[model samples]
Target chain A: MKFNNRNVHLGMNVRLGNNVRIGDNTTIYDNVAIGDNTIIANDCVIGEPSWEYYRHGENYTQPETVIGASALIRSHTILYAGSSFGENFTTGHRVTIRENCRFGRDCQVGTLTNIQGDVTFGDYCKMHSNVLIAEFSTIGNHVFIYPFTVFTNDTHPPSNHYKGPTIGDYSVITVHCIILPAVKIGTHCLVGANSVVNKDLPDFSFAVGSPAKIMRDVRELGGGGLYPWVYNFERGMPWQGIGFDVWSQQQ
Target chain B: MKFNNRNVHLGMNVRLGNNVRIGDNTTIYDNVAIGDNTIIANDCVIGEPSWEYYRHGENYTQPETVIGASALIRSHTILYAGSSFGENFTTGHRVTIRENCRFGRDCQVGTLTNIQGDVTFGDYCKMHSNVLIAEFSTIGNHVFIYPFTVFTNDTHPPSNHYKGPTIGDYSVITVHCIILPAVKIGTHCLVGANSVVNKDLPDFSFAVGSPAKIMRDVRELGGGGLYPWVYNFERGMPWQGIGFDVWSQQQ
Candidate 1:
């Protein structure tokens, strides 16, 4: 369909609230629900087709997708069936939240990030660009995931095999890091950049290196150093946004 | 730096053309050049601090970034130092084009995709979301790089060290595919999803499996079969800026 056409082929089960502005070339399919003040950007596809696993052919169930009020989903994003976002959540472009995933309120998911199926993100979580949170993962409040990080769903993943994985909450996964499947990261933990996490991380700790060793304790890094000396130029000086002179000196 | 502040900075050495629109909170640093009809969405970081790369002590060089005419870079994307785009090039959200890469006309780089330095993409290339293209690579015309694909710079990379890789034109690098560096992909090639390629691909061949083998020649798949039925779907529908019903299949 053309870009500004919203009233096309919508399902009867779809519901949208007031001030909900959708962008060009967006498709909101059947069986979707969105709340008020939720602005969706251009070229997004909500409620795409999905498959359900069945031991027998007759037993299959497809789930519904939902989004809460004031949530901002940007352009080219795909929200599959059985996926959802909570209130005041803001995501950068092209984020793919897979089926059966749930995100809590005020979550800032970065662009090009993928939160796989059966994953749950807690409130106020901020994830940077190019992060991959695999299936069955659990993310806690105020968790931060940096750019170019990856989380796997299977430790022994054969090529062309599909398996499930899991993770814990309140953790910070740093840049270019990789986490193996079924390894649970505890709450308030920190994972350093370029590390390969093959084991479970303990709570309130800092982990680094390949196979990710737990290095310094959390208290040593001062509460895991969520806010470091390097002011995130990303958050402060956005594209076309203004700068703070106070923080510019530190850079 | 607040998001909506108006006293934004566009550097003096930057060259901007007509109809080049920038979004809020974006910073285009000095010595940058942007072309006409380029639309950059919100919260993007265009230029870097300087052209100086640190290698131990002394050697440093600086180069400016250039965005060509009709290039559309979406929100939260970063075009780092010495990157350039050709006409009608588009990229998805939170994407990062690292240093010293260039694109030809009508290229589409997907959301959260990361293109490392010294790469070249030819005309009408399309890349899906969350892909990683490492340094010193080359892409040909009408190429399609799928989502979650990764290209490494070296075959036997000195574990965590940098290496250079390359790809030829008109190749299809499928989803979740990883290419080890120093490996060259030939022209008109098709790489299957989730395959790890460690060697060079022959021209007009379809390679698949781990350490990808040449499964079929392109001439074989091009024959009139069930494959021909699927190729029509591979041609994505165009987005004409109008109302619906002219393009909707339902109508």
Candidate 2:
């Protein structure tokens, strides 16, 4: 059930699994592998050349892009070479996933989000619209990011060394927040809207405001609970229908 | 005269004015009206079903999307049903205008900007790339918003009532500013970059910082001046015939 529309270009050694739908004018370049039940929407440029330029106009040879099963990639997305995604990866329109990135299972990225090169995301991470995760960032499992958030990687532009932020498991970053370069947010932390995180935040903290200060512990906050999706995955991936009852109960 | 491609899907009762160009794989749904000299780029999804779903499985039946004359909707834009745009409307690539949104004449929305449902914009509003205007917001005439600005519509999530911010005429909101819900920014105000706007700002004020405070009047600022495009519009939409003079002068 592979439907390759007109003007779709598949490069050398590209492997697409069963029930894969490739839309018109979409280009999946060399060494890419897309798993079963994946839909790559129209005008997407998957496995494009990496944006890694070395000294004196030299470019790094990008590795292949590997996409797992049940992925829904919306229109106009540009997934550069050397990126990998696990099962159940969903993205809204015009997402840009750059080179050398790894996304774990059940990751949902919203519209216009740009994950720069060399980023890593653990399972069940959700990023809302218009977010930017800079290069070399590491996000743990069950992380939720709201709209218009930015994670900086370089303190100064054109620096030789760039170190992005690190977020532990179950961290929540609210709308319009900016995490500066090399910042670390520990597990189960909640960063409030319009905040700027410049330092390290401890586990189970509720941080708010510009230059985000730890307000209180997560236990002190009402309506704070573990992500329902994680609970479903614990039972066995509910998206795959193994734990539908557990997922529905949470909903 | 409508020029439909092999893969273009024009719905029933859709009206296209003279000299309209729609690119390949574009879908214009039922009751959409496009005026003369409009260009809709490739892979666009025009008049798509709105994301206005209510509890108990009820959904809002969106009205027709209407576009005025001399518009340029770039590639991969998703203009939902019930949105109305005035003359000379220009949008960058992959823009998303939700249902029931009203954009005035000469409005320019940049790439990846999302205008949520029920938003209203006055004439000549220019929003830069990656902006998010939440639902129910009102922007007055000659408003210029820089990149990555977020307008919050609700103080708390899942609240029954939501109220967005009000931006007055000739105001300029710089990059990475977040305007809180129900806040009012007065006419001709200038909000600086990376600021969090939590309170009402007076007319002609220049505000900055977290919980943005008014530093001085905009007139006192060195670079304070009307947007160059306004000068061209005053000269009777010179962009149509002035041979890029108005456009290049600004650059």
Candidate 3:
């Protein structure tokens, strides 16, 4: 949608609408389209690393990345290869969204968060600072993650190996929680602070403690957990609320 | 000796002398001391865990840490239990001196550097930001370590395990170098940036490149390597015609 004075290589598949603004030290490579009212902030590295067919000892691979329109990617946020986001997305400083990841519309990511490749998120998701989302994770809509949470990618980890994790929509992962590799978290769930998740969580549940266990069910306890009461004292409003009416349903 | 309004406990065999100043939020437990003109800054935790002689069980183990005269321990610099420093020391923010270590006088440690336990440094040592000194290492006098250099503690490392590395002093370790553990570096050598030290280097030599090897000798190259060049540029002074006799060692 926008172009810097620096080098840019665009493909024929690229498209853009009006009033899109791009800042300094940003790179948006080929095969990307941006919608209207999108603002890509300063020092952002967007899109995939493109090259001709590679010959690595007679083996090779090919991949691509995409971005939806009206996505407000903030400063120093890196959207690596094979990653995609829906419209009206906003992310804070130093956020890394790795390759093959997808985000729903109006998603918000806080500062210094690291999101690994091949993860998918539903609409209106929110994540806080210093959070790590490992590869192949799935997150549903209306999810909230607090600061300093880490998600792993390898269940059986030999050093430097990566697999992935999974998280469903409408989930609230609290501050300082660590989700171990290959763990799957269900939808409409609440994970307390400083908890370590090592296994699967049931849907519509509330989980807590060091190694997380289900405290109660969300539908039985209430539609939403006690998060609204506890987070009322947090300083400064990050955002008000997201309109979920126009969100597209995933097949 | 120094004592402020913070919580402090002095154990047996602790020592102290004249002209010491301690700041707020400092906790000084057993087996430590203050030398003359030594000013410890705010929010410091000094001294080691004390030995407790129990009615039963094996003998308790605790080591002592000492601070020398005219030493300037700055704010948030933590001297962990079982560490000591000689006279005329200055340290920057959040510098960590781990247990069982010793340092000679006139050593300047830069911000966020970690000096592990059981390490020793000679006099007139200068270290820059984010440098890591491994355990059981020894450094000689007049040594200069640049920013972001890492000295390892184990040659054969198992993920979170710690071993030790050794170094001879009067050496200049450049920025962003990685010194593998258990390797010994000799005295009066110059190590370049981004180099990885794998084996022992001889004294009075220059080493560079990954898996560093000896390139030149500092004695033959003369003029104290590149320090004078950087110092002249930093001080806005000309390189030539400056008499060394007029330059006082004390600032």
Candidate 4:
């Protein structure tokens, strides 16, 4: 393992596997475990205290962050305390994964993406650049989210109760889509660009526009044929193919 | 030039003009040049390799990133190889500009904005937070793009053909507007918030709604009078406006 500077702080009981690289000024707190071949870039803050607090100035307990094998966390990314990631977790620059976030294997998060506290993602979930997944969101496997998509959790201002949306498996959300609080998007659904998803979506539905309505089914337009790249991730070869495949897939 | 640590790598033949201040953990690669009085914040990776490659495993040649005078690059921003900028390039946090991107003088890119490879922007172009400019996009001078705007480059999936939209000078794209590929947005046009731009817009037109159509001429509502802040950028003071100019532009 290579440490670019001695100023890098590794707290008590922190375990790092073989060939792990921690860059300059990176601070990993206590009880954090990073698996093998994981590269944590410069100035990243891992296992920071959570932002959950009570109205009376009390704070919630902070938990440990566990990163699985072959994870590549880029520079300036912040992983709040209590976050856990599966194997082959990769993120672009300035990504923020908040406290109590759980991710499955081979999930790729793009640059400037923020997953707020209590978010859960299944395997091979890819999010494009500048995406915001609010707290308590649950995403199933093979879900693809395009750029500037926002999953909002709050309905009323200053409300104590906040519930995020639940996305089913193989759902594709295009660019600049906004998913309202507590919305349930079913599997194999496609939400077009600039859509505002307010209600629930059925399986294999194609929805578009603000307050998005179902336009057609994926099976009607030849299912799985429109998105050949989704098959690559399903087959565990997430990084294969040309510019359309690699660059377009939030990697 | 102020280096936070001596371990910061300043590559060979890198010309840094006077009063250039680079923050901690910043790596400026070889052949990169920064003009006088530029401030690059922490954890920025300047002049990294481009994300372009051929089908036969051959990668595109990396190019130098040139920053003009009096620029301010905030934290966690990554400028890929083959990018060039004119004077006074001010950007918010975590902006990523890919390879072969070109920018003119006094351009302000807001936080979490990503300009994909081969994009071009003219002088006094101001893009708000979380904007995505896809590959081959061309933007003219004095263009103001609001938050969550996306310029798409691809129409059909799995096809090799890619083309981006061309936004003309003095145009204002309001928040959450999506410009589809190959569309031409004319000069002095105004696209309303959350509009989906699927076709071409004429000069001085005001467009709104999905599959954006021209509603009226911008000159009908008094040209340049509606946006007083555009004149502020034309002058030297980008941030010298009052509350109406600063707060209303975002909120």
Considering every candidate listed, which one attains the maximal TM-score?
4
TM-score of chain A of 2: 0.85
Models ranked on TM-score? 4, 2, 1, 3
Judged by TM-score relative to the true structure, which candidate is superior, 1 or 2? Answer: 2
Q: After superposition, which runs of candidate 2 have C-alpha atoms over 4 Å from their true positions?
A: A1-4, A12-18, A51-64, A155-157, A208-210, A218-251, B1-13, B23-31, B41-45, B48-63, B74-78, B154-163, B186-190, B200-206, B214-251
Tell me the spans in candidate 1 whose CA falls farther than 4 Å from its real position. A1-112, A115-251, B1-7, B49-62, B159-163, B222-251
Model 1 C-alpha lDDT per residue in residues A191-211, reported as the tens digit of each score: 887676777777776899755
lDDT per residue, candidate 4, A1-251, as tens digits?
12346468987778999978897668997779999988787668898775453332344554678999988887678998788999999887778888889999999998888888899999888887788999999999878898888999888857988999999987888888899999999987888888899999998888988789888876656554664335433334354555335644685
Candidate 1: interface RMSD equals 12.3
Over B1-251, each residue of candidate 2 has an lDDT whose tens digit, in order, gives: 33458577776678999999998777776779999999988778887654331111134454789999999999778898898999999999879888899998999999979888899999888999979998899999878999888998756432335799999987889998889889999987889998888899988888998878899887767665543234324433334555345654865
Q: Could you tell me which 10 consecutive residues in candidate 2 chain A have the lowest summed lDDT?
A: A227-236
- Interface RMS deviation of candidate 3: 20.0
Global fold similarity of model 1 (TM-score): 0.51
TM-score of the second chain, each candidate in turn, equals 0.81, 0.85, 0.77, 0.85
What stretches of model 4 exceed 4 Å from their correct place?
A: A1-3, A51-62, A154-158, A221-251, B1-9, B23-27, B41-44, B48-62, B74-76, B156-162, B222-251
Sliding window of 10 residues with minimal summed lDDT for model 4 chain B: B50-59
Candidate 4 chain A, poorest ten consecutive residues by summed lDDT:
A228-237
Docking verdict class for candidate 2 = incorrect
- List each candidate's DockQ score: 0.02, 0.20, 0.02, 0.31
